[model samples]
Every structure is written in structure tokens, then in C-alpha cells.
Target: MQNSILLTGATGFVGGAILNRLHHEKKHSVVAVIRGDSHLQMQNVPTVRIGTFDSDTQWKENLVGSDVIIHSAARVHVMNDTEANPLAAFRKVNVEGTLNLARQAAASGVRRFIFISSIKVNGEGTTLGTAYNADDAPAPVDPYGISKMEAEQGLRKLAEETTMEVVIIRPVLVYGPGVKANFLSMMRWLNKGIPLPFGAIYNSRSLVALDNLVDLVLTCINHPAAANQTFLVSDGEDLSTTELLSKMANALHKPARLIPVPCWVLQGGAALLGKNGLSQRLCGSLRVDITKTRNLLGWTPPVSVDEALAATALHFQEHQ
Candidate 1:
């Protein structure tokens, strides 16, 4: 469909990728809302500057003539949050802020609102043989997850009260292009031939390529089936920690050197070192079933995991 769309978080990995695709496709009139001081200058894609995204952020003039608003902006999880009340800090931007934006967009005549929520809304990790789906009740653990769950609840209530259609997408770890944090660190360590203890990690996890997620977002722009539905997304393939490392090694053209350390031993060591969370992320299972996403929208991830990993490795090499 050819319609005007307003996008938030244009400076982020996910939002930036979406903006680049929209600019390349030229299928819709696009408006990117970003931080006021951000020096992001893109050709063709117009931008609106909102200094800070919170409950008070303005959007009437910006949302004008926009039929769709892709709300990809959020306050991501912090490893070391210094706030006295971390939940309140997260609520300011993630819950209250998100609802504020949605309320304004609905009032401004926006037809559809696509919210980029996190898989954490389901929980941190799943049992080895189990995966999360939209039917599962939200089991948010930390402040970040709790905040996202609240925002999603608010959005659904808003949708019931307004004319706007809401599409919620909860994706597993998103990787590719300008990836950072744990994914980048993993690649860097692998490239330097760092022998990892994940050789024996038999746990499974899922990831989504940036291209795949952006493609799904674009599809939701007009697909009636996606409206007012929550989707759990992944790469359609689950890999153990060892398998993921091996794939990364292959993509980076490096030999994998892994130690067959016992999972219990690693967990015990991590507990002693106060890194249990880190160990769990490496050794536990967290997967999502996207069968509904595929069946409802007839959409498939265009980029294969191996191809996405190769492209990510290439980008890392060039940047380094």
C-alpha cells in the first residue's frame, strides 16, 4: 500500500535498517522521528526532531498525514542500572512514554500503529524443549521486561478504545548490520581465536536477522491479518550455543577452539563469580515459535542465518 508512515527510533539498529529500506523502496512517504541533536541526515526520508521521548513528548504536527506509525523507539535494558527504582526509571520511557506516543498518534488520525516490543515480555529463558508463543502469558522478569509488558497492555487497551489498529512483534535477539553489545562481543572474541567454553553448551536459542525483521515490519504496514495481533518471531531455526559459535566461526573464516566444559561446572563457577545471568544466557534455552507470524502474514525471513552471519562478519571486518 502507498501511504504516509511515521517511524520512531530511526537512529537505532532496527529502526535505521527499516528507514534505509523505506528510503530504498520509495513505496511510502516516510517521516523519521529522532533525537533533536542527532546529526542523522538522510536523503529523501524527512525527519522530525523530538529531544526526548517520554510521556510529555509532542507528536500532533509530526503525525499529520501519516497513516502508520512504527514505534520502534524504546529504553533498552541496562546491565548496570544506577537508578534507585529501576522499574520506575524504565516506566518513564518504555511504558508511560510509549502510551503517550500512541495516544497522540491515535488522536492525530493515524490508522495503524506497529509497536516493536521485546521477546523478554515472554520471559528470560524457556525450558530446553519448550518455546514461547503469543498464547503464553507474559512472564516478564526484570525491569525492562516488565516495562515492555506494561506498554503492550496499555497499547492493547488503547486499541480497544480507539480506531487505530495495533500490531505487536516480539523478536528474539536481533543481529546483523550495526550489531553491538553481546553479539558484537561474541564475534570479536571469535575473530581473535579466543577459545570459548560454550563448546558443551547444548541449550537452544533463536535470533532474527535485521533484514528479516524489517521485511516483517514493512509487511505489517498494510496487511489486515497483522492488525491487533501479537506475534512471536525468530529465525525459524534454533541452535545450541556451540552450534551458534561454530556458525560464527565459519562465517568469520576462523577455526573454532572450544572446550567441552560441563554445563553444571560453568553454572557453579558463574554463581561464585556473580555472573549467573551471563552463564544462563549462554547455557539456557530461549526460543520462539513464529508459525503464526508465517501463517497469518504469509511472510518468511528473507535472510538465512548463515547469510546474515556472513554479512554481519563482513561488516565487522570493514569497521574494524
Candidate 2:
């Protein structure tokens, strides 16, 4: 049974990976939705061009004969957001735009809608001994997290009102071959053998490999238990800042040049530099318990962290 899947953010990291996975699996028919023209070539997959995604963006013409909707596109969280009314700006795209698409998908008789949400919806950070689960009450702190929380709320309401099965997946920091931002930056610093101040940081954090996340998305597509379920996903292993850096260095065949600076000193420096949030990321603990995800979906991350890190390092080396 081939399901016609309408995929948004097809040009993005997660969505593009999903598209490639679907293509290799040779199972489903995919329709890649892009905000503009793309040069991405696929054998039989077709592309749908649309304008800015918003409350009023027309999706009817593109929704025809679509069985599933994978909504992975959103206004990502950034450093030092300068947008006035950041929440409103995020809502216009994440909440309003997402709900708008879900509303239209329901009306158009789309069977399932897979939403890629963030773990920030849980909260900023947790202690090393505790972990966030799907049933935990949401405590979004930032505009992006708040928007995603609102979007999830709206989607749950729409699912109850309609027959569309909604699957919400909250993933921790994602990393893989084409990862960018902080993860990539850390890799670059490691490759150059730069001394980092994360040696004394014992904070535990969870991560999901790109392949693992894509596998989970594919699982939720046809799984009956996935309907109306919110799942927290990770690699099922937590790593401290020092452990992570060493692993990255090992993958890159570089020496881990980490200095054991006191955590207090780093926090104090961050405070002076107005990088408190950055400091928290480098020093705070954030973990997600994916027990429910595995029990319900009968799935586990197939890619080991070491394997994924090696692939990421190889890609970085080739490109550099």
C-alpha cells in the first residue's frame, strides 16, 4: 500500500533527510513542498511550489490525493533574536500556519499528520537524575518553544474535532552529516585542536541522530498506536559535555583539547558577557526519557552515536 505523503520543509535538514529515506525505502510516494523553486532532483518524486506559509497560504491544490502531511518546517530558535514581539512572529508561522494546514488537511481528508516539535516545549533544562517524558506538563520558556507548544495544543484540539490522526514527536538536539549551528561549530573547534572549557562540565544532555529521527517519523506514519500520541525521542544515551567532546575528537582523529576550568568561573564569565543561555547549554543538564516511545512504537535508534559522529566527522573532513 503506497501512501501519498505531502512533506513540508523538503529543502531543510530533517525534511530533506526524510525525503531521501522515503526514496531509498521505495515504499511511499512523496510530494516535496518548497517555499520557492529548488534544484533538488528526484527520480519520480514531484515538487510543489508555494508562497510563504501562513494562516492564509492555500494548500488545497497541493493537498489533493495526499494521505499524510509531514509538517517539519518552522521558525527555528536563533541566538539574539532581534524581532520585536518574537512570540507573535513565531505564531504567525508555527502556530497559526501549522494549525491552518492541519485544519485544511482534516477537511481534505488527510489520514495522518506528523508534526516535528522540539524538546524545548518541556522546559529549559532538567537535573541529571530526572528526564522529560511525553506526559510531563509543557513548560515552554522561549518564544519558539511557546509557539510549538501552542501549535501542539491547537493540533490536539483539531485532531479531537476531526478524524485526522496527529502524531507529535519532540526531539532533542539533532545531529548528523549536515548539522549546523553549535554542534557543527564544536566539531570545527575540535578539528582545529582548540582548547574548550567544557572539561569540568558534568551536565548530561540527550541527542537524536538524523537517521534515528527519520526512522521514528516513518514509524509513526502507519503505526496505529501513533495516533494522537506525543513521544519524546533521543539516542537512549546521555552524555556529559566532556564525554561528548572527547567522542567528537575521537571521531575526527584529533586530540581533545579540553581544559578543566571551574564551572563557576565559566558561569561568571557568561554572566559578564550576557551569554547566560549559552552557558546553560554548555553547563546545564537536559535529558529526555524515550521509554514510552520504544514501548509503544517498538522502535529503537538503529544508528549508534559513535557511528553517526564518525559519519559527521567524515563529511566535515571531506568538505573542509
Candidate 3:
């Protein structure tokens, strides 16, 4: 069902991808909330420029009569040791900012609030051979994850108190064109012909392509099965680090220079460099069960990992 949707984080990576999909499909009239200087990117869309997050985005009025509220803005960082209060900084945007927008949406009588949360809320993706599902208890380990978990609770509570239906989506490691962080790092490494030592590793990890995630988000916006439910999503396929890198190299038409370094030795070396945590994160298992999303909404990821990787490789080849 086409509806008026208030899309936050329209300038961000995943959110931008969602916006592009929505526009091309012409499924929703989007009211994009963006920063003042970032208005250039929202040229053809109805937009509102806001400078702060404290109950003053002026986008609230736009939320009136909207069908869905896709809240995608958040404070995301792998590591944060800045002198500033970390929890407060994240809470301000992730929790408080979210509440502010949610409150407005509720007050505006929006139908559903679709929150794009991270899998970190479930905790570090270790504990190999185990997959996290929607019903599993939340065990967030980092400040960011904690804040997101808190926000989830707040949204649930708000839903009980208001008319808005909340659809919480926990996506694990999303990748596509315009990817960043570890995905970009891997791309650069492969592009430079660097031999990575991940060939010997065989830990399974789950990832979601941007298009797959966008499709699920669209489903959450209107599907009856998604109303007031939490879901975990992935590409519906698991790939080990070696398989991932090899596929990436193949997509880039570069030789897969993967060395056969033993996992224990790599872990020990990382431990000596005070990067044992990095070792755990990079080589750990993070499989997620996406059965609920598929069975409930009758949705499926539209692209294979190979196709997604090829698209990303082409994107980098054109832009970088």
C-alpha cells in the first residue's frame, strides 16, 4: 500500500538506499528530515531541514496523516573512547532523538513505526555454531547496543500507550553498493592485491544486502504479520570469511590471495597486540535466523551474495 512516510536518516547509507527504492517504486510520498547543509541531497523530495534533535525538527507536522515512520538515524561507531559522555551522546540521538520523533509520530496518528536496529543489541556475535533468533534474550555488550536495546523498550512502551504499531528489525552486517567500515576495508584490501590470512577460517556469519533489507522494511511498514513484532534478518544464507573474501575477489576479477594462517595463531597474535577483541569480532560467528521474517511476511532476499558483491565491486571501481 502506498502511503505517506516520514523517513529519517534519508542521507545515510542504508536509509539513502531505502529512499532510492521508494522513489523508483513510487510507493510512498516521503518527507525527508535532513540537516541544514545536507538539503542538497533531498532536492526532489519534500524536505525539512532541522539543526537539532530536541523536540524541534519541525518535521512533526509532516508526520500528520503519514502511514509509516521509518526511524533509521542513529549514532553508529565501532569504537568510541572520546572524552564526551558516550552513553549520553548515543542516548541523545539514538534514544532521546528516537523518542522525540516517535512521540511526534504517535501524536500525528501515524500507523506504524518501523525501527532499523542493529544486531549488536543481541550481543557480540561469537558463540560459534549458535544462531540468534528474534525470541532470544537481548544481551547487548556495547554502549551503542545498550542504547539501541533501551530504545527498543521505549518504542514498545510507547506503542502500548499510543496507537502506533512498532516493527523492530535487527539486521546483521548489511552490505551493498556504498558500503562502509569492514566491508569497505575488505574491498580496499582486495583491490590492492593484499593476501589476507582469512582463508583458513571457517566461521559462519550472516549478512543482509541493502535491497533485501529495504524489501523487509517495506514489508514491515504494512504487513499485518509484522505489526508489533521483532524480527532478525539476513541474506538467508551463511558464508564463512574465506568464502566471503573469495567471492569478493572473484567479483572484482582479482586473484583471491588468501593465505592459510591458522585461526589459533592469528588469535594469539591479535592478543599480543591488544587486539584480541578485534580477532573475536572479525573471526567470530554471527549467524542470524531469518525464518520469522520470511515465514511471517512471505518475504525473501531478492539477490544472491555473489550478485550483491559484484554490484559493490562495480560501485567501487566506478567511484574509487
Error of 2 at 118 (Å): 0.6
Per-residue lDDT tens digits of candidate 1, residues 168-246?
9998999997799999999999999998887898999999999999999999999999989999887898999999999
Question: Cα deviation of 172 in candidate 1 (Å)?
Answer: 0.5
Quick one: ranking by lDDT, best first? 2, 1, 3
In candidate 3, stretches whose alpha carbon ends up further than 4 angstroms from where it belongs are: 40-42, 55-59
Least well predicted 10-residue stretch by lDDT in candidate 2: 36-45
Each model's lDDT comes to 0.92, 0.93, 0.86
Candidate 3: TM-score? 0.96
Task: Report how far off residue 56 is in candidate 2 (Å).
Answer: 0.4
User: Between prediction 1 and prediction 2, which has the larger lDDT?
Assistant: 2
Model 2, residue 164: displacement in angstroms?
Answer: 0.6
Deviation of model 2 at 80, angstroms? 1.9
Q: What is the lDDT of residue 94 in candidate 3?
A: 88
The C-alpha RMSD of each candidate to the native structure, in angstroms, is 0.9, 1.0, 1.5
Q: Give the Å error, residue 188, model 2.
A: 0.8
Ten-residue region with minimum lDDT total, candidate 1: 36-45
